[model samples]
Target: MRAILAPLWNNAYLLMTLTCLFWAGNSVIGRAARDLVPPVGLAFWRWVLAFTLLIGVAWPYLKRDREILLKQWRWVVALGALGVGAFNTLLYSGLQYTTAINALLMQSAQPPLIMLMAFFLFRDRTGPVQIVGVLLSLVGVLVIVAGGDIDVLIHLRLNPGDAIILGAMLLWVLYSVLLRFRPPVHPLSFLAATFGIAILFITPFYVMELMAGRRIVPVAESFATIAYVGIFPSLLAYAFFNRGVELLGPGRAGVFLNLMPVFGSLLAIALLGERFTTAHAVGIGLIGIGLLLTRKA
Candidate 1:
């Protein structure tokens, strides 16, 4: 029994699972608050809160690594802009027009897209297994888009949110690849720096959203959503994910991302009373198989 449960006790597995669970909750929150809070406002405030809390906790390490952090400012800014700012802002924006289940299902494309991007940018090679995995995952995503009916492909209609979410997923893949260049600081320090940078990048867009008449009202629901996002997805999830990356390496760590759609869809069903259809199960199953195959790929 001890041997059977050994993998569950590992930090990588625990961290990765927790990270996915937090992100799954994020999808629910984002979708729930889509009408109450402006996307840019939510993105900005989430990072502001995350940065303030992180800097308070991690200031010692950040101060010690000030020189190294400055030297790596470019990578930090790029990572912050893509991962923390753009990806989340886009995700929240898309949630305005999509279900949490659909948004997360679209995100299932990330690993395969990362493989392609890595291949193009870094000349990383993919095996036949990876190619097969990519194909299977792509089919699953299409099934989700088609809503269990192949005839929907005749017109191939897509929600506007799906396109936006695709962009969000790609930004996250780029951010993941770019993490290799981050300075060797404590994970807390790294998160603090990125959160600050992300806040800086998002401020302008948030202002624009305000100027465009999408002002965020001060309401309990909005603040509650922001508070949840700031604490869970922005802070703890990032910390857990970075630690998991450290423990398992990016390739292996990424395989656990398959759990996001599963958890997200379940939460959506349980909390939002969304339907669980055969299409969802079939799509999730194929995506899970694809992600598992990537281990050998």
Candidate 2:
């Protein structure tokens, strides 16, 4: 088994797959516990915990890279704000009002959004195959959103949650595009810096959440949710995703995100007792094919 898995162990795609799986879990947890913890509080405490865990691990590198980090502070702050602060807070907020299925479908729009942003901002060229892959993956998401009925979309339904999630997706796309400017620092240091800035940026909003009388109920489940998101998604998933983006570049890395809904659906079946339907199978198939096409070109 070790021999068989050896080659795949170091594969960037596998790392990205793990990242998406953890993130899918994050979404599920966020949605499941939406009533237990307010979104801003959840988002705030998640990074607070992640930052606490990361700082010690990253301190040595951070000390060594202090000058470079200071020199590039603005870029780091932007990364933290968009990728960490806004993206997650918005996502959690959206989950309060939307189904996970709807949110993940909105998120599937990230690839093409990233592609278009790259083209305009960086003059990065996407090949025809990549475009086709993106479209196919998008179609798969549409299938989920429309509940396998094309006519459902004709009603042009609009909801606050969908809009919020779409906005979150836009923040993530911008964050992914901005990753090209990441300074050459240790991943730990980078994560530490971003987590710190993200926490700082979200502090006001978190205060407002408290001021508005929305507080996190200190329950075992709430703490469990925060702890899981802190360790897995915030720390490990970000580490894995950063490595994947470094190895494969953001565009290719974005392709693996198509797996999120697949993982989300499976998780729903296992945890929430949601039915596994034909639409899910077909959507998963299309996403798999789309990933393969992404690999082709």
- TM agreement with the true structure for every prediction: 0.84, 0.94
Best by lDDT: 2
Displacement of residue 228 (Cα, Å) in model 2 is: 1.1
User: What C-alpha lDDT, on a 0 to 100 scale, does residue 86 get in candidate 1?
Assistant: 92
Which candidate has the highest TM-score of all?
A: 2
Clashes of 1: 0
Tens-place lDDT digits, model 1, residues 1-297: 979755654667788888989998998888878888988899999998888778877999899888998998888889888988999999999888875546755676666666666678787667788678667766776665566887766764468988898889888888876676778987888999888888888889998999999977788998999999999998989988877766755545665676777777678679879798897789778877876676566
Clashing pairs in 2: none
Residue 133 shift from truth in candidate 1, angstroms? 4.6
After aligning candidate 2 to the native by TM-score, how far in Å is the CA of 252 from where it should be?
1.3
What is candidate 2's CA lDDT for residue 122?
89
Could you tell me how far off, in angstroms, the CA of residue 280 lies in candidate 1 after the best superposition? 4.3
> In model 2, where do residues sit more than 4 Å from their true spots?
1-10
